[model samples]
Target: MRLRAVRISRSPLLPLFLLISTALALWPAAPSTARPASCEPSVPYESGTDGYHTFRIPAALQVPDGPLLAFAEGRRDSAADDGDIDLVLRRSLDGGCTWQPLHVVADAGEDTVGNPAPVIDPDSGDVVLVTCRTIGGATKRQVVAGAVAGSVRRVYVQRSTDDGLSWSPQRDITASVKAADWRWYAVGPGHAVALRHGPHRGRLLVPANHSAGPTARSGAHSIVSDDGGLTWRVGYLSPGGDEPLALNESTLTELPDGRVYINSRDHDRTTEGSRADAYSADGGLSLSVPFRPQPMIEGPVVQGSVLQVRGLTGDEPLLYSGPSDPGERFRMRVRASGDGGLSWRPVWTVSEDRAGYSDLVQTGGGTVGLLYETGQRTYHDTIRFTRLPWVWRLLPELTVSQGEVSGSAR
Candidate 1:
């Protein structure tokens, strides 16, 4: 077959379109740091959904990398502290927009494992977690009273090298870290801090609480690891027994000046009833000042979380999350401090509904991530993760359910 060839002048629009396409291809894309607008508060774990009766005591740590490692206690049988409870973890690589499947950190077949206190070693980049293992289902009161005969609380350490993807076997360090005379001990239900500014910089400090004997009061203390979590020792023990306030479920933060600041839950409900605090300059080996009541804040003797918002220092801009209600365990509120912790201003009410234990961690892009227990009808029904940005300071108070909840977990 014969064919004819035809030629014509290229249109000016063709060159313009080519130029635009080339420019578009060469231009660098903007990083998607902004959370999805459709994201809403979501329950990562819920009771009766995961075969566990309930979940409680949240602890989250933003690893040296960009992901968040959230730890919780999965009660296999019931919501009570005793029984087949497991220390479980869920990871979020996208600043807590979504979380990975539940990963069991340490599971004792018939015993209980809980109170996850995690700290990242800045030098070695290891996520070290310390948890208490009770041989039998025993409540803190029972343990403190020495009623659970032949059953005792012990401490174990687990390390995650790949940013919390997996954890090592639990290493028993109770003998070195706990006093043999002590009857009950629990690690932080919140994230632990590492010293960065003081002479003891790079030290890993795990905030903890313990009772001396069967009838003794509980006080706050910290476990310290200097050589990147290879070994741990009892660092500082707060003075004054448990008279003024029974310190329990404590949280820690390293000040810019190198002093370790402790925020504790006070069990004494009569006179000096408030959150307790103390400071230590010796890298937690000893509290230079004893723990005292924090009169400015009030709660129903619940575990709280304290975190230093990234890039904001000098004691100002510290963030605290807990149940703000004095008489009830409702209203999960986030308060901001302008003068270290002397005074606080409510930034947002995470949930005006039923709420319980909570944890706070600053994301890679500087937004705050909170993992807490809240439910539609009860406090222990579900555990949700919420992201709060700095802009919340200007807008009217917002709750997690009102804000966007992203389901995209990468």
Candidate 2:
């Protein structure tokens, strides 16, 4: 796949400083050094060739080996080709202290590989990688001037039996199902979560979307596979509302009470650009009509990720990490929830510098690992990693089990 250089226009709501300031005022003040740990940000070692650069997005996973596996989209300098945006993987073995190198997992054959969502299947211990592939580059014209291009963009899934070392052949998901229009790009197998401890246990649920095309409405869709992504059944969620609620980049977690909660990115919401909340039940297959949005400390509207942390004392707490757009600058925020997703307590700031499109994973030792783009700008940025103590972002209800130490050095 060739890499295409499309200049994505800045969001119309680019001046977000006032919005961020207002949101910050609503947020609770930072506590006076409560839970401390080694809090040093490490620069990610860039992998891949010089000509081929990879930009990390909001997709990553953590394995028991202490390495945080991340997927990035690689591309060349030119904007003519979209096929060069291949999917590559990297690992941070020393607990996000340092990263190894980039491992090319999947390369798009004359297509663009993007929106990688990685998850670890508890039952099989296999790393499941799902990404979107654009066969001809549907949105290239939107990026480039006077360029009329179209492609068959479909989501594909690959499994790695040996952690991030090897992967199986890519399988196209929407092969049988007919799309609404040829100009429509159906991307994202967003975040795949294997149901744990419930009637839907062992099932893998993937959220996808068909962007607005020449003929169809852009809305959210979901696919479920009982047998670990080999076969899937497509379905719609929260459809036929007053306005189009295009849900994408969803994060799913099974609560301790056997309830499945999905926090999705709402593109067409009224207030929040990045809206999140819980779905009805049954892994988003049967969702409640007109889902309500959760009240997050407002910032720039961008995609985020969530993880359920099992405390040392067997307490299950939730952690959410995302880029908070403050109008002018973007920062990463970490929030905690003790009672599911109903309420949240603000935690430490993940990135003091500019950041965008973040993903989070809870390490086996209870540490939270973050993969996010760190730079002043949005698309063209560097991916950085950082780890915080499980209690770094403390909630009033939860106790700090581990001692806090300042990891000030990178």
Candidate 3:
């Protein structure tokens, strides 16, 4: 291609300047980094169509260079939290455009077995899932009030070696993950995280919550496994004595600075919205940033999910998925955090219809997949999977005082 020249006032170095500028202008521009992606929302679990009465607590996970997995609680009887609930999953091999048939991951006869917090092992390439087991009809009120026995509210583990095509049998890990003093226990209703950096890389960290005896104080903690899914142990646990922060139903995300950030749903905190956040520097074994309320991260008193994505540049941007409605469970939105989890700004709204629990996973090629509960009649009517492109910044930046979310883990 011939280079075009621009004339200027006669100067001493005019010839050289024109030659350089013309040559540089003739150079081709860098290739565009834009990645075009789109997918229509597909229902993976319809309440009345499946054998189960209702499916809730959506969890989305994708194996590295493999298929995507969507998990939920298959309530056998009704949409209630209890009564013959099972952990179910659906696999997607075509970038979540379509899904396979439903498969039951864990079923406990007439008991309730749900809270599918799944994570893919970075070392073994296996999909590990942690779940909470409870009696069929046991309510959280009764269990936290110390009326229900601890044996009912237990924890279990299961894994899939063939990319979620088949899962191993449920192995009870309550003794390794749960405490004897706790009455009520629940694993993550969202996706768990496996560490990918630092010395704790390949560690599977599962966020959980429990209410202790006597006071029935609620606290958030992590159940960690180092040898893939072989052995498990309890990690950093927060105190819930008389304080306004009654954190539960937590989510985990690993930051670029090798720290684990946790955000939980607050039931006892009346101020600073209904969400609390903390950080762990020791690979989720202990807290480093402590638990504090996020006044800017506003939402309803429901479970929210946090995910760390590296496709965006500049900083370690994170994505949060939950209902945006401050008063009710409606209008599901995905917020963006430019600086880890310290601050967040609304980016995308997955749906404005009635919605509830949601899980977020970056499938690949700068695309994020969301599996959430949404329906015309109610949020529990069905579960759908949707994929959206990472459009980077979509709104103004929002931040909060660092002093508010700064303290000890205890």
> By how many angstroms RMSD does model 2 differ from the true structure?
10.6
lDDT digits (tens) for residues 119-156 of candidate 2: 67777788877777766555545422223433355667
> Alpha-carbon error at 39 in model 1, in Å?
2.9
Tell me the tens digit of each residue's lDDT in model 1 across 17-48: 34323333443332244333325555678788
Query: What is the C-alpha lDDT profile of model 3 across 1-410, one tens digit per residue?
Result: 43233333334445334433443455433224323234566888999767888989899998888888999999998998877988998988887778999998998888889899998888888899989888646776778877777667888888899988898999999988777888889999889988978899989899999887567878899988899989999998896455568889999899988899999888876567899899999999998877888877777899888988755543546889888888899988878886788788776666678999999888774567788899879998989887643333222332211121111100
Off by over 4 Å in 1: 1-38, 149-151, 312-316, 392-410
Question: Sort by TM-score, best first: what order?
Answer: 3, 1, 2
Ranking by lDDT: 3, 1, 2
Give the poorly placed runs of model 2, Cα more than 4 Å off: 1-40, 45-50, 78-83, 140-151, 176-191, 212-217, 288-290, 377-380, 397-410
Q: Quote the lDDT for 403 in model 2.
A: 18
- Sliding window of 10 residues with minimal summed lDDT for model 1: 401-410
Q: Which ten residues in a row have the lowest lDDT in candidate 3?
A: 401-410
**Per-prediction TM-score:** 0.84, 0.77, 0.86
Error of 1 at 42 (Å): 2.9
Tell me the lDDT of model 3 at 212: 79
**Alpha carbon deviation, residue 389, candidate 1 (Å):** 3.5
